[model samples]
Target: MGFEKAVMVRNSTACAMEWSIELEKALRPKNPGRRIEAIYQIGLRLEQWSGEPEGTMVVYDMFGLVPGEDRLFANTIFLRLADAFQLGNKRDVKSRALALVLFGCWADFAKDSAQIRYLVLSSLVSSNVLEVRASLFATGCFSELADDFSSVVLEMVVNIVTSSETESVVRLAAVRAFAKMGCTFSNANRAFKVS
Candidate 1:
């Protein structure tokens, strides 16, 4: 079963220049949704290479594919970038930081996995001042998290909600994160009741 699944995944990721070029063209236009879609497609393929021999090389290629002057692609690009870091390679710290920022945004949208959530939170909490100044979360980057890292991210949501200094949009993102974490108002209230 595992072999079959792996083969199916590999076939799905078979190299194709046409789609890649098309994605590049859309990225050049800097269309937010289109760029995100391209990133999603590319990420699917990259994810397939998790333990493959050339996985690291493929990830590096993705990083280099980052569209110049395209902010829309920046978000999606960085999400993949973080994966690159996790897989190994500390050669480019700047790229790592950029990717880490995006990873946090992705995790905010991701589901209930303590490890994934902690990975993102660790990145966020340990980020240097310059990364924070980059405003990684300010943009329309993370619409929703997937169900892989939800619980560990809730504390971040709480911080964003309670902090007076946090930006309104950032707070809004926290609200959205809470909703995605499956913590409705009643669940949240129950915690306070116990506290």
Candidate 2:
């Protein structure tokens, strides 16, 4: 579904509520993953229109349709991908990985959902994936915990920039990410500085 349709459905109220149940059933791993894939695509489309917070919330809420039972692993992978894109990223691989991590963490800082926060944070703290870590670092949720997490992410960005074998583009992206969040690199003798 496109953003237009998602908004229309949300406004429709009847269709939105009905699809909420169907979307949950379709998310079951026992069923074909393609249905979940379709819903994910629809969510992706809606995210493009995220300027409308209510519409974005309505669209994001649809993700709850995926049953939260008997599909931990599959759902984990699925939600990760969803969150990466939803959280926003430039590349496909990075976006997908970030999605998984963010989706896993949504409930942590979300409205009255403690279990989700715990589940996601526990997994995030243990994840070995750099993109996942980066995604969480960049999320709005991370900002609440930023005082606790920024130094770590700053270190990651520094590491990515300093490593000899890292790709130039990746280093550039790290710089961009840091600048986006008001971080700066200070070098005493450098002629040009990025802030």
TM-score of each: 0.38, 0.41
Q: lDDT of each structure?
A: 0.44, 0.41
Writing each residue's lDDT as its tens digit, candidate 1 over 1-195 gives 986665444322234333445545544533445544555565555454333453334443543433222223333344334444454333434434444444544443332334334445554443343333222341223324442233334555566567788667555655555554555565466435533
Task: Quote the lDDT for 10 in model 1.
Answer: 31
Candidate No. with top TM-score: 2
- Determine the C-alpha RMSD for candidate 2 after optimal superposition of all C-alphas: 10.3
Error of 2 at 118 (Å): 10
lDDT of 2 by residue, 23-43 (tens): 455544333344446456535
RMSD of each: 13.0, 10.3
Shift of residue 58 alpha carbon in model 1, Å: 25
